[model samples]
Target: MDGSIKVKNLTKTYKGDVKAVQGVSFEVEEGEFFAFLGPNGAGKSTTVQILTTLVKPTEGEIFVGGINVKDNPEGVRRNIGVALQETGIDSVLTGRELIEMQARLFGFSKKEAKTRAVELLELVDLTGDADRPSGKYSGGMRRRLDLAMTLVHNPKVLFLDEPTTGLDPMNRKAIWKEIKRLNREEGTTIFLTTQYLEEADQLADRISIINQGRIVAEGSAEELKRTLGFDAIQLTFETTEEAEQASKVLYGIGENMEHSKEEVTIYTENGTQFLPELVRNLDEQHLSPKTINVKPPSLDDVFINVTNEEKERV
Candidate 1:
């Protein structure tokens, strides 16, 4: 538990009566990959800022690596590394110079700083371009350089806020691979925040979804999806009339139903078990669909369900 984080009743309120985070509580075990997920303006950034000591919480407490954030902000900072959404590296500096400077700022000797710089360049797969000015680097390369700079201190915990936000799919996957490797090989604790459902599903050992300054759900990706305990079967018809007609016959078989102009989605405990009956019911109603698809519950479904429920309560 050396690199663990403990948060209790954390709250942050900005000026103009804005409440960014409200009574949030969670824990991240040592060496764990934890994801904080939400839409824009959901307070994920505010929470990360609080945890990283950039912002003070209005209520409650947070401890990083056994150090109270408010009591010993420097201690908390010393043990953690942060790579924010924005690439803050100087455009004039080469990748090697940036990392070496970061290491030197962390108290490494000149020789040690150079050694750490080379090691990090290799770790981030930027060795070939280590001497190139960062201003000329692509978006993905700049992100990699930022990550390397964050690790120059060999911190026990890492905070990545939307680390792959603007990258293409190929670059996003490459960054994901590097993050996974670091967590696995270095045993570093990771706290990540992102809007991408696929990124959380792929990277987090556990996830917490925040909405309107509150945590609506927290669990493993599979666990959250399983909580729905149903599969979805989507049927696409020629028109809304046919879909509405089919819905009437298929009403009682599923727990929930959603219909669009030309499609109807049914959520049931077992889609395969209900498929034949659904088809027969539609046939009897003289309704035909253009396509049918069944899929297991996914993280997107969990997010939609939780956030929608929260919205209804508000």
Candidate 2:
């Protein structure tokens, strides 16, 4: 690809007639933190595997760092570092040893490899434990070591697949901080694949959501939330009938104006304006809601709304 990455018309199919990716296309710019997000079995791993040259796409043109992966996969491999969802670090090997091996695989001299190993251990906050066998490290420490190994090759681009899958909140935060620092200080373009929306929101400059082997949404976190409107208002009443009446008053403003046993939830563009109008209508109908809450739309809401829209069309 002339750019950092370019994939066009990508498709992947497994046995039993299952299509994993369907005509997926996207371009990642240099030094960008791009996230691939999706529910389980949404073809995320398939796409990553193709881009990293682990699996060939059934049909597509994939280029990484200006090299066509299908044609010059070796070139692509030389320019990219991949930390897969599965950690392949040798349990018996010390963190320093694994990093040294990775550096030499990329053709580093023995002295240069040793120097880089120490640097990466410090970069990933593993300097103190660099001599410990990977089997004795915590989950977060192992992940950091994996990342250090990936960076030992000094790739222009780094691929991280669910890098913080099973870590405590504190450890997850620590990893997130280092990821941002890597992108900022080293100018390493990151292709992060994660299931957690919050992780993408925090780290990705742009995010693409794939579902059912197709892209459902793509944008920055704020832009995706904007597509779902500005606010979500919850109105709770004393009875279901009162909630139903409120829905009629707010019908045109919200589509999924759901009414449960005693509450109604509505989507609106400007909840501040809509709430007053809703209150007036409810009073005229002899209904008074017991509670009203207005909150900004979130990425979770955007995912639910966009995915539901896709399902209905199917």
Candidate 3:
């Protein structure tokens, strides 16, 4: 009740009786970095909108920063900072002007707004480009500027929706550094919704994956990976024919298996223990692999498996 976020039995239904979100419930401790991951149209956006007070829920209780969203939407908004994937950056305004305007919107005087702008520009490493029109800023630079705008009021909670969706790898890393700093140095609670699974795996203290309007899994990256409960043996053969053959031979030996044109990936418990038998089976079949790499289950595997299961059920 006194924490960053708490929701119970949250549901959202639209005009056509579309159940966008169904009985979703979760919590985020103050200062915790939480990630909400889902495929598109998995009710992720609708849930965030409700929490941020941009949309109303059809049923259930929702609270953010200790305020009930339905009862005091304005109070909930005051304690939250939201930087969405499509958040606009006015092309005509300079970075400095934009940030100053945001500060003023929160009731800062001219002098205070200017000072706050200077501080934020420094915080996001945009001081050098503060005077340039935002239209000239790079994608990454614009993202940083947008993030700085969100923090103008120093809200207790920050919501970031795909903050690095289209940036090149180098720019994405830069944004990741800034976001990590917000959590570590400023002790800010971050609720992140990212298209990049690696970003969520690396940045969030805990992750919740929603599928088909319901939470299918939730945990730390490692914990979620463990949920799959198997190590992957990634075997690459000399040819597509060989790879297909390997899958046939390795069938029933693994908990599950998948293969492509030239790669056969077998998932099984105790990969090391299975290696000896795998080698023998390949030798017997006269199949020589180009590479055989063993790895623990990755976040990608967990996400795909969970969502794929949901699809199968539907």
Candidate 4:
């Protein structure tokens, strides 16, 4: 598949010399679900804004739908749809009104715009509430309406910035279903930025995790998880001091060893095979763990492992 979105050496700086985005580069293939996974203030939104033409970049190249961003921002805009985190529909406008207005703004004729509005309301499963004022709709309903408005013009590429943030589980699932269908059925390339670990792991075909303005890790969920090459054995001690001491006593026995408060997590190959040896090490050091559990590497671990620069290693 061709690259639907391409970004190269992209950098953005604010007035105080703070680098919001630093030489970041990645590409999203056509009809692929690509996620920019990061915590807040990690430049996910900045990068999205630049690609959507709402904000200009300080340096590097960008293209959307085969159009150069800098040379033809307007042309790029025409081919893309953006649904930002905040839903800003007018309180008095009904769901249908919001969608119809959006379709008309994109140059749809009066009759065509009305027909398009009805189709979108059904698409987002809001046909039952089509005529209800947005202010009266629940949070999930409002979010769905905002999403439908973005789809009025049938954009080739869709940019969703934290689309399901602050939503309940059912509501988040609702939004995910719609977007997944768009990608599968309509072949729309999706660019999503999210802080939710499960969101990226479940929805993205590939993910790039960013932290402190740099791309820390990039791969499919399974590929990134495999990088750890070990299971995590978590031991909880009764006291923080014991946890700290246990970390030192078991230093070279594990891969990336780290302790926080009363918990020490040891990552190593064959975790089940290493449990007895681990207990012996603690016993020899006169330390006792209150509880122990083992789990495979997850996206949450990948996030924490990459974001923390001072990783304790064997």
lDDT of 1 by residue, 1-314 (tens): 27899999999988987999989999999999999988888999989889999889999889999899999998888889999875488999999999999998889999999999989999888999999999999999999899999998888999999999999998899889988987999899999999987798899999998988999988997886666557889899988889888888888778777777888888878899889998988888788899999987554555556765666789
State how far residue 26 of model 1 sits from its true place (Å): 0.7
What TM-score does model 3 achieve against the real structure? 0.83
RMSD of 4: 2.8
Worst 10 residues of 4 by lDDT: 305-314
1-314 per-residue lDDT for model 4 (tens digits):
23399899999999999999999999888999999988889899999999999899999999888888999998887888999876488999999998999999889999999999999988888999999889999989899999999999999999999999989999999999999999888999999999886788889999998987889888997887676447889999999999999999999898777689999998887889999999998899899999999987654565567755334432
The candidate, 1 or 2, that scores higher on lDDT is 1
lDDT of each: 0.88, 0.85, 0.87, 0.88
Which candidate wins on TM-score? 4
Worst 10 residues of 3 by lDDT: 296-305
Quick one: how many clashes does candidate 1 have?
Answer: 0
lDDT against true structure, model 2: 0.85
Preferred candidate (TM-score higher): 1 or 4: 4
Model 1 C-alpha lDDT versus the unseen true structure: 0.88
Q: How accurate is candidate 4 locally (lDDT)?
A: 0.88
Model 4 earns a TM-score of 0.90
Q: 152-208, model 2: which lDDT tens digit per residue?
A: 777898898888888899889988998898898888899999888789989999999
**Range of the 10 consecutive residues with the lowest summed lDDT in candidate 2:** 296-305
